[model samples]
Structure formats: C-alpha cells, structure tokens
Target chain A: MTKAVSSQPKTKRGIERRAKILAAAEQVIGEKGFAAASIADITRAADTASGTFYIYFSGKDVLFRELVEDMGRATRSQAAERIATAANRLEAERAGLEAYLIVVRDRPMQYRIVEEARFVDPDAYRTYYSEFGKAYADQLQQAAERGEISAGDAEVRAWALMGIAKTLGERFVLWEEGEVDIERVVAEAHQFICNGLAP
Target chain B: MTKAVSSQPKTKRGIERRAKILAAAEQVIGEKGFAAASIADITRAADTASGTFYIYFSGKDVLFRELVEDMGRATRSQAAERIATAANRLEAERAGLEAYLIVVRDRPMQYRIVEEARFVDPDAYRTYYSEFGKAYADQLQQAAERGEISAGDAEVRAWALMGIAKTLGERFVLWEEGEVDIERVVAEAHQFICNGLAP
Candidate 1:
C-alpha cells in the first residue's frame, strides 16, 4: 500500500498526525455518524489534542467530507484499474463487476461510510457520485464502442450499471458478514448486466 | 383515495389526527433526520398537542417505523398487482419493472425516506428489503422457469435483476431528476435484466 503523501508536505510528524486523525475520524464517524460525530470525540479517539485536530481539519464536517472523498476515490481507482485492461465491452464489464465485488468485500467499512454520507450531506454526495460515476461511465462507453454492448446511450447505461453493481455489492458483499461466493456473484452480476434473463 | 379504513376503525377525529401527525413527522424527519427529530417539533408541525402525538404513536421511532411500513406495503401491493396480470415471463418482467418505476416516480419522497431509513435503522432495512426483494424474485423465478431467462440460478438472477431495477429506480428516477429519459431508461433497465447489453 502506498503511503498517502499529502500534497502540502509538512514535517513527517505533521503527516503522521493527519493520518492518525483521519483513521480516528473514520472509526468515530462510522460508529456514530457524520451528524453526531464531534471534533472532541475524534481527537479523543486519535489520542491527539483538540488543537492538533484543528490543525489538520477545519471542523468535524470537513474531516468527514475528506474521509468520504478519500474512500470514494480509492474505490473508483481500484475499479478503474481492474477494468482498464479489458479489450472489449463484455470483458470490461466483467472486470468492472469483479473489481467492485473485490473492493467492497475488502473494504466494507470505508465503502458503507461513503454511501451513508451520501444522505447525511448532499454536497459531499454530489461530489463523490459524479466523480466516481463519470469514471465508471467512461469505462462503460469504451466497452460500448468495442461492440461488446448494443450501443445506444453510454452515460445512461454506465450510471444504470453503476447502480446495479453498487446495490448488489452493498447487499451481498459489504453488508453481509458471512463468507460469500464473490466470483459467482460477480459472474451473475456480469451476466445480468450483459444479457437480460431472457432465454 | 380511500377513506381511513384500518382493520379496526377509529373515530373521524382520531383518524384526522393520525394523518396530520404522520404528515408532520415526514417533514420534520426529512429535514432534521431520525435522531434529532423531536416530539415537540413533530407536534408543532402538525398543530396538535404534544400529548396527542402519543395518541397515535408510542413515540417518534415507532411513528417512523409505521411510516416506512405503510409506504412499503403500498408500493408492494401495486407491484403485486402488476406482476399478477402478466401471462408470460417477459410480460411479467416488463410489468414488474413498470410497476416499480411508476411507484417510485409517483411517490419519490416516500421512497427516499424508506431508502434513507434503511441506512439509519438496520432492522427496518432488513425487513423491508427482504420482503420486497422476495416478491420481485418470486416473479422472476416464474419467468425463469418458463424459459424467460437462460437456464441459470433463478434466485441469483432475480436478485441481480431486482438489483438493477432498484439501482435505476432509486438512483435515476428518485435521485437524479431530468438526467435520464424515463422511458428509455426503463427500456434499458428491462434490456439489462432480460437481454443484457451484449450484442
């Protein structure tokens, strides 16, 4: 895993403090919620002083928004990489579905937090949804052009597919605690997306 | 619309109070969220006495639960009707999609509330998701057995299709307004479920 090097490179201590604060923020916000989570609680969780917290985050909301964005960006980047190598639409779609399953399965807490924050704050929701959504759509459009899917509307199809992958990932992979056949579920999702159930 | 007719009939005054309280509960909860919405604010919104609020609901959480159930039941009944009328598997699948789209578009606020409550309240989310999900799957199973879908797992197919429909309905129809063509979107959703996008 790459160390998240902050653009504003302060001292090594500063980077470590920010990472500590963000880790604490994810735990606090996920357990309680964005609305109820406070800077005091976050700092307490991180074992950092309140003053140190303000140095990294402007406020609780700002911290939570960054947390949401980071999670979203991470998930999309992973999915983008998995599908990036596919030569055709069907293969790309399959890779994309499998990638999503892997991402949500591996990082359930971070993923759920991103989704919950969607309703807790609309501004954050739009930023995350469109940013990730457009990237996901770009993959779909490439697949569509490869003659993998009968082309009509790439944007609509991409968003629609993103919704399906998201819902299924949340239900079967993220929310469920027990082991799931992720490969089977991914195949099922790919099949459902590529070919409707019609015989 | 039908008059207030529960299994046990209430006085006209009692019924009106219930309606007013429910309406107020929706607004307050929608704006303020489940945790922060207080009895006083809810009653104030309805113009009813705070004491009278308890006459209809045991408390705020109870009212919220009932509000969710009522919306779910209403939507489910409509979907059930549409699914029942279809003679073939394709028709059944198409009707089911149309039924969902109509209910979601017709009652977006209630739909959003139900979806949000699912994230906020786990038990309610499970109950509602399982019930409606099973209902949609049952319809899909009939179609699959009749050779509407390829010879694959019906349950997985059902959930996949439902996932697709749900993602489209919740994300596009309810969340993204004017971003998608309703008819085309519906057609594409059905295609993904029945034929998939694959050429």
Candidate 2:
C-alpha cells in the first residue's frame, strides 16, 4: 500500500485510465518479466501516454508490488466465495482447491507475476503468502474446535494444504493446454485429504 | 542439455574450471537474479578470465539451465539415498521430507535458482519437476500395490506430497534463521500424511 507515487484518481476518467494501465501492465510485465519490461512498454500496451504510467505508479517496482498484492486480493476473495458454499471444513478444502485451479487456468499470467514477486519484491512476496497462511491457519483452528477436522497442528496443516493446491494448479492447469479435469483431480485429492495414506 | 554454445570440458583442469564457473554463476545469479547478473560478474566471482566462461558455457541461458539440471541431480540423489533406508513408503515419505528440508537449508541459493528457472528457462524448470513427479508417482504406485499405503491416484498424491514437502521447506526452513527443528516438523507432517485430517 505504499503510494510510491500517484495519488488515488478522483475523477471517473482518471480511475478508468489507471485501471486500464494496470491491466496492460499485467500483460506486459507478465510476458516480458519485471526486468526486461519497461514503463514505455507498459504504457504502449495500455495505449496511453508514457507519462500516464507515472501518474498511476511511481515506477516499475511499485507497479510490480501492487500487482502481487492485487493478485493476492483477487485469489483470497475468489477462495472465500467458493469456500462459503461448502458444507464443512472438508468440503471447503475441495471447494478451495477447485477455485484455486480455476483461477490459475483463467489468469495464468497473474499467477506467474505473483511468483516473480519473490525475486522482484521479496517483501511483498513474503507478505502475500504470510498473510494468507495466517488467515488459513486461523480457519483450520476454528474448524478443529468444532470437530470439523481431526485436531492437529493447524499451522502445519494450513501450509501443507496450500502446497497441495498450488502444486496441482501448476502441474495440471498451467502446464497443460488441454482442458483441465479439475473436478477429477479435486475428487481424488479430497479423498487423500480426508483419509491418510495409511493401509 | 541444449548446448547453446560450449561443449563439455575434456581434461580434469578443464572440468574443474567449468565447475568453478558454475558455482560462481549460482552465487551471482541466485543473488542478483538472471537478468541483473552479468557474464563479467560470474567470471570475476569465479576468478577466471571472461573468455574462460565461453569455454565452459555458451551463454547465460545455458549456464542457468545447467544449474537447474544440477540441482535436480543433486536433490534426486540425496532423496534416493535417504529413501533407500526407509522401512516402507510411509517411512520413506518422512525421510524424503526431512531430506528435502535439509537440502533447502544447506543450499538455499540453489533452491532459489531453480525456482527462478521458471522465468529464465521454462523448459528446464518444467523438465526438472516433471521428471521428479514421474518418478515419485511410480514409487507411490508400487507402495500402494504392496499395501504399504492406501491406494489412490498416484500422480495426484505424488504432487500433493511433493507440495507439502516443498511448501514446508520454504516456510519452516528457508525463511527462518532460528533452528528449524526439522524432526518436529517431519513428525507432525508424517501424522497428517499417514492418517490425514479425518477423525
């Protein structure tokens, strides 16, 4: 939330222009990466004057951090809405994984950009996952108290579950051009999540 | 394995020089990232002439790919040795997770470099994980057949288990300066892996 530059746009036109620039930045930065992509490149893609970028973001670093934050917000909101529909914690896990894969398939660029944040803006990258992990762990703790899930290390389980969704999304959705069978993957993974691999 | 420029060195001295350059490149590229790191920087760090790098690597991209491959080899060998001692697949799972965390702790730079390969060299990045995933799935299938673990989708479970180990390594080992207590993390994770979250 560091306004490195550019105050919030007051006018409708200004807001629309800013949004357009961000959308274009996502495409440009996502393709060319943070280092090779320049402000000129972003503005050109946005079809706005080069000066317009400075009006919205201080520089490339600020824009990159903002993109990471933006992706985090979008992903969390999507997961929240999907998880709300589930009957219990177990169902919520399936819902959340399905929602995450769908997001990765639809917005693959944003996913890549968020990962790139690990190098470009380490602080933002750490904060993005740390905050999500904290909230996720809290939810697991509450579910355990309700006997929705077997009691265990909520923090450890939270990270382990997140790992499952993230890796699956990368392997099955992002890597494949074919239609991803997310439902099947979810069903199988859900079984493992519910029951340990014990004989 | 794409020799975009140079071939393998013939003599022992030549091989040592190549190894030195690769090691230096790992330090530089891992620290400054691929785009920011320069040939001169790598050569200087290796204490070799700039011309000598061309004798070992064709360019930065080739060196980066080689580094990715090297990490894969190193990690796989480590996991194989540790897993060989396990009494069964369940024990192997715990041993493998512990070994992975130890590798991350010891070679944090190599881990970062491999991740960076997703952007710098997509083919290498995909190949690294795809090969590992295939082997992991095979082992899971064998274990399930032998009744060492519950039967499930081997591919799905492989990725899930890998995700757990990877995310845990990043969170509990790489990010922390304090003693990571690897044994405790492995024990808690092993329980969840064995019994899952269901009561």
Predicted model with the maximum lDDT: 2
- Model 2 alpha-carbon drift over 4 Å, by segment: A1-3, B1-6
lDDT of 1 by residue, B1-199 (tens): 4333223228998888888888888778766777778999999999989998766666676788777887777666876898788777877777767777777777665666676775667788778876766776776676667776576655566666666666677667767756645677777666666677888
Put down candidate 2 lDDT per residue, B1-199, tens digits, no spaces. Answer: 7548757888999999999999999899989999889999999999999999988777998889888888878777888999998999999998888888888888888889989998888888898999999999999999999999999999999999989988998899988668888888899899999998886
**Candidate 1 similarity to native, TM-score:** 0.88
TM-score of 2: 0.94
For candidate 2 chain A, the 10 contiguous residues with the lowest summed lDDT are A1-10
Pairs clashing within candidate 2? none
Top TM-score prediction, candidate number: 2
Each model's RMSD to truth, in Å?
5.2, 2.3
User: On a 0 to 1 DockQ scale, where is model 2?
Assistant: 0.82
Q: lDDT (0-100) at residue B198 of candidate 1?
A: 80
